[model samples]
Target chain A: MNEYTFPIVFGVFIGVVTRLYLLKTDYRQYPTYLHGKIIHIALGFIAAGLGTIAVPAIMEKEFAAITFLALAASQFRDVRNMERNTLNELDQYELVPRGKPYIEGIAIVFEGRNYLVIFASFVSTLAYLVWNIWAGVIASIIGLLVARKFMSGSRLKDIVDIEYVEPHFEGAGLYVDNIYIMNIGLPARQKEILRYGMGFILKPKNFNARSTIANLGQRQAILHDISTALGVYRDSGTPALVPLAKRDLDDGRVGIFILPQEKDIEKAKTIIGNVPTLENAIRMPTKSEANKKGRKLR
Target chain B: MTHEKLILAVITTNSNKIAGGAPIFTCDTREEMESVATNLEAILDGIAHSLSDELLIIVKH
Candidate 1:
């Protein structure tokens, strides 16, 4: 086997395999169609080729070929914007909308993943060129493990304690674990809520988690994910049935109320637990002087 | 607070006519009506807005 050709092919194969493995996650369940999968996989193959070809180009003293990396960077950024646009358009029709923060987070993750694939292929090819094919295989495994670790970010459950709570209405006001949510006007609607609704209390484990949960965008993401996974019970123009998340000012705990069609509490909890914490929604209390003084800021 | 009567507010963009049996505020733009409705909803009970029908409703109970 020729050194250059075999290493390049193996590197590309490993890179594409790693990319496909990472794409098998459950969060951000969009672009599920066969066409969408094909597009991403094709892009991953291109990224792998770019990385694997760089080693041969450099070995041949063709330094100008490195410019292709810059092109790939810009192309991936376009991928980010495309993801943001598609998700934003889809958000309009969602019963529990994934807010802007969640969409931005998803877009950034997708862009970063392409770069990871490139890195994996580049490292694998370099190891093969230096030593042997066996060494390249080991390098590929290590590269994939690192990429997989980077892919799994902190979830809401990692930072906060999520517990199922009883949903009840005190007079006309809805309450979840003593935190007041919204008010229900119609008795029939209230009856429906009591019958089919599930409630949860998100108790922040620490200051960092508290501020994160306090973010309206973060709470909306949590509600959207759970509602989407468990199936929300609202149609267009039905405002009362929309999922709501309200924070208790006295404490940092947040209350969530959702009317899901399936009413599967276990599935809802699992979905909520798996929601990736939005990057923009994380607020560090110690970073600001006002927060250091224990002044609560939402 | 328990014995007090609930207050309700209705904000609508439809200037043609106000619905019967309730005092409602009319605004030229949907933004203004939504602001009024949201503020009322926060203080009182709840708010519901319909974009297609052009209605901003505030309910208190």
Candidate 2:
């Protein structure tokens, strides 16, 4: 019945729509089940309600209500924990586990997207209350653009050059390029590995990229992503048929060895190229003070 | 008390080379050693790594 009622409704609607837009289940296949989608949608609705009420609360001089935003922050943090716990539990049985870093990265994204929904709601509500419905629509559009910008991080192809290399063995040792992967004792197992395995070498583009790709977590993420995209040719009690990534000590190149069911090199390369560079795994060594000084000296 | 990486068993053609803590199965021929190693690998769920032609150790990771 109040003037703020329509604005609040509009804000919440925009926020939920924004959340729906962002909650896409791509090749990652996360939140793919109906129950998972329902859980996220419920959380998104709560975030929208919190965001929408803040505008009127501010206008009514109920500044105390603003403190609820702090409550929302903590609430979203729990969403991150929930995601982490669920993913960690499921990771145990995976053919190729997503690793800690990839799980953490996914959890962080779920929390961050909630905040983006809040921002979209707040902006649109403020616009609707102050100006008009058209202005609120425009504001929500701008909000969505900002959210899209924040959603995507750098991909593997941005920082590395990927080249396919057929895995070869020297005696018992299996190698991808010059990188030593592992040793296979059994001739039959070695033959199986050679038949099913595919290898790729990732060369870092710069000094910063060198350290990033060298991270064990980042390397594991690459392996997990590739395994998930293309089916893994591994089973329980078959440890010999596992995928591995080894780094070259001399150069900052990484060698990837995978046992995928599908032997499509082009498809696998595209999947690797699209793998998101984990935010936690990114190391900006060149930006460091000591490194900057050394660069100046040279 | 718990070992993350431990040698589960040893399959070798040469008995003189290894005198160790883990269970050892000495075979007469290279083919016999390989078969034993493969069986132990399946039973113990560990990887069989050959140190030499005569020695193969199954280690759990």
Candidate 3:
């Protein structure tokens, strides 16, 4: 109803949206239930709005400090608890092809990052124009930084440091995989644990990183003897089966990863851009414990 | 501990087991180390995905 209420509510709303936006935009490489985080942030806004009104009436000078502390404390408690909740179980292993025939796409219009910038500024000020837009601007930065911090960067880091398997056999059948070409890398400080093959089970269309493991225990005719009996057969002029170039991320830039199909080994050699081997791969020196400024792999 | 440190410690230990030797990453070159790292990470991920309970147990440190 009052002037303070408008800005306070506006600020809180902005803060929540910004938090959600970063989580959505930057978290392409990793997984954290985005839906739940949106809910968490929206509730944070409602809490901020209510606190803005209630705090000023009770304690004017210290209202900002009190509200901020309360938010930090309460948020830490709830999120920490949520993080601690151990995994209960997993669904049955359902098989689905890439982009597993789902309804087109989910649609949500973005109001852009500018609105988020303004809204976050307002919440920190707590319904007051006591400081100029300078304060609001600072608050906006702080809000965005804090929100990203809340998310962490572990997932982003790990995704960048990818692994490739050269067509190895395993037990869970044959799984052709590649990382989902979403936005890559960490957004500031968001940490995530990304599961390639397993997550594929959850997301039908999610193109996962290729696997080197397969479950084909059935060993065919002795390939080694074939290689030995002939005593190193000359390279057959016939072309091997080629892997389809899948452009899932839409950046026009195809992704990189290791594959497990040895049959296509020859084709893959041509299809893959830069397949690093033991000879060419950059063997980064392992960081010593004393070195704090280490180059992060992920 | 740092993220890489935590991950590397487990990976090195596992690679050591696989190689039946010391923690040399079972790799002779940079390329091999990278490949080995990738497989090791996948192994860790597969473990996590298939056995979250076990991952939690192993990651207790």
Query: How would the docking of model 2 be graded?
Result: high
Which of the two, 2 or 3, has more TM-score? 2
Ranking by DockQ: 2, 1, 3
* lDDT of candidate 2 over B1-61, digit per residue (tens): 9998999999999999899799999999999999998888888899999898999999998
lDDT of each: 0.81, 0.93, 0.31
Residue runs of model 1 more than 4 Å from their true location after superposition? A25-28, A287-298, B1-61
Give candidate 2 regions above 4 Å deviation.
A295-298
Model 2, range A1-298, lDDT digits (tens) per residue?
8899999999999999989999998888899779999999999999998999999999999999999999999999999999999999999988899999989999999999999999999999999999999999999999899989999899999999999999999988999988999989999899999999999999999988898899888999999999988889888888888899999988889999999989999999999999899999998888888888745421
DockQ of each: 0.06, 0.83, 0.02
Considering the two chains of model 1, state its CAPRI-style docking category: incorrect
User: Model 1: clashing residue pairs?
Assistant: none
> What would the per-residue lDDT of candidate 1 be over residues B1-61, giving only the tens digit for each residue?
4734333566777856556655688888867766666555556645443323456555432
* Chain B structural similarity as TM-score, candidate 2: 0.95
Task: Give residue A124's lDDT in candidate 3 (0 to 100).
Answer: 57
Tens digits of per-residue lDDT for model 1, A175-239: 99899887664445677789888899999888888989999899999888877777878765455
TM-score of 3: 0.33
TM-score of chain B of 3: 0.36
Candidate 3 lDDT score at position A237: 22
Q: Indicate the residue-level lDDT of A217 in model 1.
A: 90
Report the TM-score of the second chain of model 1 against its true counterpart.
0.63
